[model samples]
Target: MDSGETKISLKDAENEEKEQFKLLHKYEAEVPKTFEEAISETGFGRFNYTLLVVILFPCATQMVETVGMTYIVPVAECDLHLTIEDKGLLNGVTFAGMISSGLFWGYLCDALGRKKIIVYGYLVTGFFSVMAAMSTSKGMLMGAKFMSGLIMHLSKSKAVLIPIIIFFLFVEFHAWNVFMLICASMTIISGILYMFLPESPKYLMSMGRNRAALVVMRKVYSKNTGKPQEDFPVKKLVNEAKQNFTSSRVEMATALKSGWEEMKTILHRPHINNMILASFNAFSIVMSLNTLKFWLPGIFQSISDYQNNHNGTSSSMCVMLGEMSKPKNITSSQECSVVKFHAWNVFMLICASMTIISGILYMFLPESPKYLMSMGRNRAALVVMRKVYSKNTGNPQEDFPVKKLVNEAKQNFTSSRVEMATALKSGWEEMKTILHRPHINNMILASFNAFSVVMRQVFSSLLVILTFISATCMFCIYFARSSLAVTILSAAGTAVGSVPENLLLTITLELFPTTLRTIALSIHLTAQRFGTTLGNAIFPYLVQMGCLPPFLFIGIFASATGLLSMLYANTENKPLI
Candidate 1:
């Protein structure tokens, strides 16, 4: 009888355990799956637009340094007495600096934060740019250029800088030293403006500073919706902070150790292959873009020289500024030539001034929420989501689903540390993930596309040169005339080469998960720098072999990149996984 009673009791306990598990699962199901869903409820608002514009400023500055250098070579050639090798060295030196520092910067940005690196980068880059401007000799300028590249972050400074340089060159302000100084001043102003900008809320949360991230969100909400900060989600954020810590108290040393291990995860599984593909893409793009950008001025000079000789025209036709309207300050009877200090300085000043204004305006921009969530700063991430929703709909904080967001944070982040540990331990698994299915094919395709694009650009430029050379040799019977045709062909090739530059980051970003995003980007950028350095070194030597070989060699790389593109998955419109 006693034995029978004990058996019945055991059956009852099993039933109780099953019921409790059912209840737990039901509760979890009610929670939201991800932070992005909450963020989507926040209407895309002016704040986002403003952020984009602000971010674009750095891009402009980056462009200025990169593309502007090419323009500087020809104009400064007389002043600095640069040879062909010197010009190639100038073009490639900055990339070398970038290669050395890109991985380091990426690692820091991932481990520490993005804002600090970006702000500091601008300051250091500007300082070096000033050094370059004040350079008295070729060696000084080359050193300055390399340092500038090493310190500077990537962006789209070329578009504006190019026009400005051309205009200045046209106006007889071709002195590279003064132009560089002007660029440096603008960069410094930009850095100062970055100081006022808010840290990325995502970065803060990743560091487990949910409350601070929440505070940032509240400020953004208040600024956008004109609402009082009285009804803040303090409870939600507090819970999120709690969830981020696996232990009630993790030591700083332990956390940092974890973070280091976390960085090493990029080399594992799905991420490793992605990293490789991204790096190769970067290499291909940088090679093509820098090769063209750095060589444009030299090509133009060659063309101008050829035309001047063949046409027996004392006036120039091939220079960018020469084609534009001359300033009224110069007499109509005065001979127009590439002046050492053109009115283009005013344009450079204007461009720099505009970038400064943008930097100041961007101070209002917030951090990326995805980055925040990855760091297990769910509460902070939620706050940003709420702000997004509130700003878009002009609604009070109460209207949003705060509890659901909290639940999602709890469920998703409950094992964040465990996941990190898993990622660190299962590096091979991650690699396997990347090597299979959609990712593998995509990587293969993208790599080939990149290879082909670069190769085509290089090959086409050389081919164009050859085609023009043969045509001119057969018809015009003058080497100088052939030089002008080849130079123009080079310009066209450069234009083609740069056309695909804007797509690199977009595609790479969409492919990688948030956890590996920054590191992947760093790897990509580093590879690109390497490629650029190689191209710069090789292109000059190839040109020495009489132009045709350079294009053929470039064509081979382009063909490879292009073939890779065939396998590239359309990441466009796909959500980040």
Candidate 2:
């Protein structure tokens, strides 16, 4: 009778445990689950103190640096006595420094953690900002800028910086946008470094420390934020801790080391193919964004110019200056600096507004579901999915709790070796399937090569044609319009020549995991920054050579980017968190 009673008691406890899990799962998601829900449920109000502080502050600091760097273009021409050609070279060199250090910093951050990486970026960048200001020579400035590149927090920095850079041209003239970004980036970096910053919750959970993940999540997500508890499961988490036991899930000292493990999992029949697919996507996205960003401002300004000319209106701002305001009158160094300061300020603001719009788009994009699922956060993934997808489509017949999945992976699979083998086999099988999927990768690569050949041939002759176009236009416009129109047009042209297009961030979020996103962006942007440096460096020489058509390089880079974009699968409406 005692044995019977003991068995009954044990069974009762198990049932109770199951019931608790069910309750926890029932409240799947409380935060903004849909577009309408975002305003009400997101960190919309100041109540979610932590969320607002973290997200907004980092963004602000990043923008300031971007605005400062981009504004350097206008300033460089005057402060360093740079010709229009020299301006391009300086920008390109600074960007090249950024590209060179990106992967290195990314690896370090992944190895160490986000907190240290971000704080370091602040300290280093802030210090360099002062250094850049103090430099007496162009060489000195270049060295200081390179040092700034060395210290960037690859992943954390990019999320904030990318938007700012993209909008640098638009906001170059807008003070408000520049102010907002600078404030936001500063707030994020400072707040997180000083206090209350928790490490990535998903990273913690992946290593089987469910309790640790819970504690961090609670600390990170304040009650005031109105975020769903489903995003952070206590009992469900405790349950998941039991299931992921294997040689594969062991903890390591650094997340970078973990990345190596992930790479192993990533490669093989399925993941390898996906990695290749991702690589191609990355190649296209990065190249495209870089090229287009370099040329966007020019295109936009050109359009404005065309419209003005068609309407027979004058546009150059320089020619409209007061008769007393001659180069001789503005000979003082301070005067030139003042002009540059004002010019950059206005340009950064326009770009800042556009960047802010992009940020809003990011908020709408959902986080990576595969990442959560891999980490055994099915319940949370489900909640995020509901928020992102439930209203329209792919809503499961009903909420399939994490407990059900966990039990199957642990109990049903443990007794069945065949099932375990199936899971192991699936990883590699997926890779093979991808490569064979119409073999599109090879075809695209070939096409790009062919395209490059044709382009090079045309570009050789096109240079002369471009020079003719610029000379004719400059002749007609300079003489045909009033001085005021000339100044208006120059301002207009600068605007067109600098704005980064939409493809950069859009492709990044779509192609990479939350974990890998920043690194991927760093690599791509690094390439872009280097390309910019080259353009900046070589452009002045090209201009001096007589064509004065500085925009051709920008156009070439953009075309290359577009062509590469065709190699990857379109991420246009695809989910990117």
Which ranges of candidate 1 are over 4 A from the true structure?
1-46, 110-112, 152-174, 231-235, 238-282, 310-520, 564-577
Cα lDDT tens digits, model 2, 190-266, are 53343345655455554455555565554333343435434433333422322333323433344456556655654
lDDT of 1 by residue, 1-577 (tens): 9999999999999999999999997665445322343233233344565567656657778777776777787767666666677778887888788776654554466555678777887877886786677565789888888878776434544344455444334433345767777777767766766776678766666556666666666655555444545433332332233343432234456556655766689778866776676667567756755675577567656656555555844332223222211122334323334454445555666577777677666656666667776666677677777778777997866577764333233355557687886788699557646654577778899999898567545643443343334323222211223445545555555555454444556567767888767666666667777888888787776666554555456555644454454444555435677
- Top candidate on lDDT is 1
474 Cα displacement, candidate 2 (Å): 15
TM-score, every prediction = 0.57, 0.46
> How many clashes does the backbone of model 2 have?
66
